[model samples]
Each structure stands twice: as C-alpha cells, then as structure tokens.
Target: MKRRIAREKAVQILFQLDVAEVQLPDAIDMVMEDSTGESTEFLLSLVHGTLENLPAIDAEIQKYLRNWKLDRIANVDRSVLRLAFYELMFDEATPDRVVLNEAVELAKLFSDEQSYKFINGVLSAYLQAGATTTES
Candidate 1:
C-alpha cells in the first residue's frame, strides 16, 4: 500500500483509539483487518510512535497553537497533527514539505473544512521555530 493509504489508516485507528479508548494493538488490528503488506509496518510504526510519544507530540503541537489550546483542537485534527509531527521529529528520511503536505491532505480528508488550514498554520509555525525531537 502507498504511504498515503497507510496514513489514512493510521488516522482512522488513531481516531478510534481517541474516541473509543481502544487498546493500541486492537486498534491496529481493527484497521489492518483486511490488509497484508509492508505498508502495515509503516502504519504500525506511526501509530505506536505517536501514542508512545503522545505527551511530547502534544506539547510540540501546543507550542504552535497561537491562541488555541491543544484540548480545544478537534480530535481528528489532533490525530493528524500527531502523525505528521511524529514524522517531522522521528522520520528524518521524509522531507519537511512532504510531511506538511501529507498532513494537510490528511486533515482535508478526515477533518472539518477549516481543519486543513489550521493544521497547515500550526505545522508551518513549528517549522519556522526550528524544532527538533531533542528540543521538546
């Protein structure tokens, strides 16, 4: 599967985990029910890494929120941000622009109409601030 597909699946699983409080493994299993491929590895990595480092990821996102609180952000938007932020911080092989674009795409697909703009702004701010995984 394409990375975009993996990302979309990751967002679904994350959303499920967030709303239903499903266990991480079960969430992954739910999303990967009909899939079988290397793409699943990437999806698993994304979900596990995001959840494992959720606090740090949330804090990173919180810093980029100009007037908005992290909690005030929509769950779908938050999950999108978390996945993108994880890539920015941990997956250095992918360029920042790709990460940002993919994240915006995810927001456009899974979130409310204005969510993509909000996600773009926050991610742009984070890039401008020159943050790295080590910093926060």
Candidate 2:
C-alpha cells in the first residue's frame, strides 16, 4: 500500500486503540483486514512505534495543545497527531516537512472541517520548537 493509504489506515488503527481499547496487533489487524497488498512494513512500524512510544508522543502533543487536553481532542485529530509525531520524532527516513504535510492532509481527509488547521498549527509549533530540521 502507498504510504498515504498506510497513514490513513494508521490513523484508523490508532483510533481503535485509543477509543475501542483494542490491543496494538488487533488494531493493526482490524485496519488491514480489508486492505489487499504485500508491503505493510511501513504501516506496521507506524502503529507499533506509535503505541510503543505513546507516552512520549502524548507528552509532546500536550506541549502544543493550548487549552485542549490530549484526550479531549477529536479522536481522528488525536490519531493524526500521534501518527505524525511518530514520524516527526522517530522516523528519520521521511522528511519532517513531509510528516507535517501528511499530517495536515490526514486531518483534512478524516477529521472535522476545521481540524486541518488545528493539526497544522500543532505540528508547526512542534517544528518551531526546534525538535529537528525539516531539511531533506
């Protein structure tokens, strides 16, 4: 599957894990059940890495949130941030700009009408905080 599609599925699987109280493998399996493909390594790393590093990711997200609590944000929005943060903070192969762009796109594709801005704002703040370079 394309990375975009994998990201969409990652958001869904993360949503399940966050809301439905599903295990990591079960969340991944549920999302992949309908997908027809061979390469899932990217998707697997996303969900697994997100879950594995959830505490740190959530903490980073909390730093960006103004008044909104992590749990209080829309599920889809939260999922998008988690997935994006994993790439932004953990995955070095993908550029930080790409991660930021992908995050906004994910929010636009899945969340509420205004969620894209919210996602963009949060991720942009993360970048500005000097987490890392966005240079490719």
Candidate 3:
C-alpha cells in the first residue's frame, strides 16, 4: 500500500480502537480485509507503535494543547495526532516534515475544517520544542 493510504488506514484503525474498543490484532485484521497486495506491515507498525506509546504520545499532545483538554479534542483529530506524533517521536527514517504534512492532510480528510489548523498548530509546537529528538 502507498504510505499515504497506509497512514489513512492507520488513522481509521486507531479511531476504531478508540471508539469501538477493538482489540489490536482484531482491528488490524478487520482493516486488512479490504486491502490486498498492499503491504500491511507499515500500517500494523503505526497502529501497534502508536498504541504501545499512547501514554507518552498523549502526554506530549497535552503539553501542546494549550487550554483544550485531550478528551475534548475530536476523536479523529486525536487519532491523527497520535499517529503522526508516533512517527515524529519514533520513526527517525521519515523526516518530521513528512510526518507533519501527512498528519495535517489526514486531519483535513478525516476531521472537520478547523481541525487541520489545530492539528498543525499542536504538531508544530511539538516539533519546535524538540520533544522527541532526544528520545532514547
């Protein structure tokens, strides 16, 4: 699968996990059903890695959220942030800009009009703070 498609799928699976409380493996299987000849490995990595590091990711997002609480953020927007933040913090191979752009794009597609701005602002803040560069 194209990385964009995989990323979008990752967001969807993440959203499903949050709202439906689906098991990780089951969620992966469910999303993969419609996909064929598309490498699921990347998608699975994003889903599992984001879930594995959710607490830390949420904490990072909270720091940049300003006045808004985490739970008050839209589920789709939160999922997009979580996935992008995972890439920013852990996937060193992909540049931060790519992750941020993809995340904003995903936000545009999956979330409300104003959500992209909020997502972009929060991510830009996270990057500017260099919060993930020293992750070890």
Which tens-of-lDDT digit does each residue in 1-136 have in candidate 3?
9899999999999999998967877877787888867778888888888988999889888999989999999999999999998998888878999999999999989888799999999999998897755472
Which residue pairs come into collision in candidate 3?
1-38, 1-39
lDDT by residue (tens digit), candidate 1, 21-56: 688788888888888655577878888888888998
Q: What TM-score does prediction 3 earn? A: 0.94
Residue 34 in candidate 3, Cα distance off native in Å: 1.7
Better of 1 and 3 by TM-score: 3
Candidate 2: Cα lDDT at 121 = 94
Candidate number of the best lDDT: 3
Q: Which stretches of candidate 2 lie over 4 Å from their true place?
A: 133-136
lDDT at residue 29 of model 2 (Cα atoms): 77
TM-score of every model?
Answer: 0.91, 0.92, 0.94
Sorted on lDDT, best first, the list reads 3, 2, 1
Clash pairs, candidate 2, are: none
Candidate 2 lDDT by residue in tens digits, 1-136? 8999989998999999788877887877778887767689898889888888898889989999999999899988999999998899888989999999999999988977689999999999989999853222
